[model samples]
Target: MPLHKVININSSTTIFLWKITESFEDLFDEVQLKDINLIRLNTMKSELHQRGFLSVRKLLSHCGYTDFDLIYDQSGKPYLEDGKHISISHSHEFSTIVLSDQNIGIDLELVKEKVLRIAPRFMDISHLDNLSEQDQMKKATIIWGIKEAVFKLKNEVGISFTDHIFEDPFLLSDKKGTAKLRFNEGVEQFTIVFEEIENYMLVCALKDE
Candidate 1:
């Protein structure tokens, strides 16, 4: 994977993702953030490969001309002081950020067989038992991608998957699906399209009237 991209799938909305496929070493060399941002290696979530991710974020903050300290709401939503709506996602070898005027959420996942084992809990039986031979790993990733996006948009801890699931037409076997989301009587709720890049899946959720 090479880190050289800023593909704009939808330019009108400024909904684009910066994907860096190179090693974190390359990312470190490309962007400098070691000065203002400190990695609290002593105390932080284990999920982070270490405090290295914070530095990556600091690099993004620098690009956005933002000062660092982002606070997380009880719902686990990360907030930026500037009013620029944003969403970010990173996987084993990829990192992405989605920018928009409206509230936005993003998710990235490395396709794996484990996703199939866990689909039943979040997905209805229709998602599982109904798949034809046409439904392949790539196809299943589409549903997971959209659902992941919705989860980011909602950002509420207790929001049940059953209540928040999309009800529009789902994609047939081996195809990607799109839908306009309606979540918890909210304002300007939306469901953006999902796209595949490299070996990862990306979902973008936005709120714009």
Candidate 2:
């Protein structure tokens, strides 16, 4: 399928989402990959992942970019040649990219029952209190994405989801929240926005400035 959705988070930030319905060959034939990325693509063992990677390239094309315009830093954070900050994420059959003039991170997660089972490990379990099992799963997934997106934005080592990131309680209906990163003797605030996309949670984090 073509670009599934385009979300204008603000005047300066935008998100593009793609539903991965094409086979690996279809995606690979559509996008040109840099030599290094070509090797990385071929080395991937999972075909689903390969398709996801190429799907990201397809998304780049939608934004008037190619694989050559996308580069990664030493910490494996992606950036655009035009000096825009970009964050990439793919889960199950969905892939998304968010671009902003400011620091940003994004995460896409398929809602699953397993998140509730392990909620205690990474989040404040009290946040899940008094919610239905289904709601618990969705909230847990959102919190996990919150931590993951924050980590991607920071891209620093030794940041633990359970230890360094804290998410404020929010109802599933709110569709937005806030979090704090208490690391390196500093406290950084983030504004979080999320949405439900066909049983998947698409979460974005931006530095509160």
Top-scoring candidate (lDDT): 2
Give the lowest summed-lDDT range of ten residues in model 2.
115-124
What does the lDDT come to for candidate 1? 0.56
Q: For model 2, what is the alpha-carbon lDDT of residue 127?
A: 91
Summarize candidate 2's per-residue lDDT along 73-175 as a digit string, tens digits: 9989999999999999999799999999999999999999999889989998999889899989999999999999999999999999999999987889998
Native-referenced Cα lDDT, model 2: 0.95
Q: Tens digit of lDDT per residue, candidate 1, span 127-181?
A: 4455553354545566666667777776766655555655345554323344444
Model 2: runs farther than 4 Å from truth? none
Top model number, TM-score:
2
What overall lDDT goes with each candidate model?
A: 0.56, 0.95
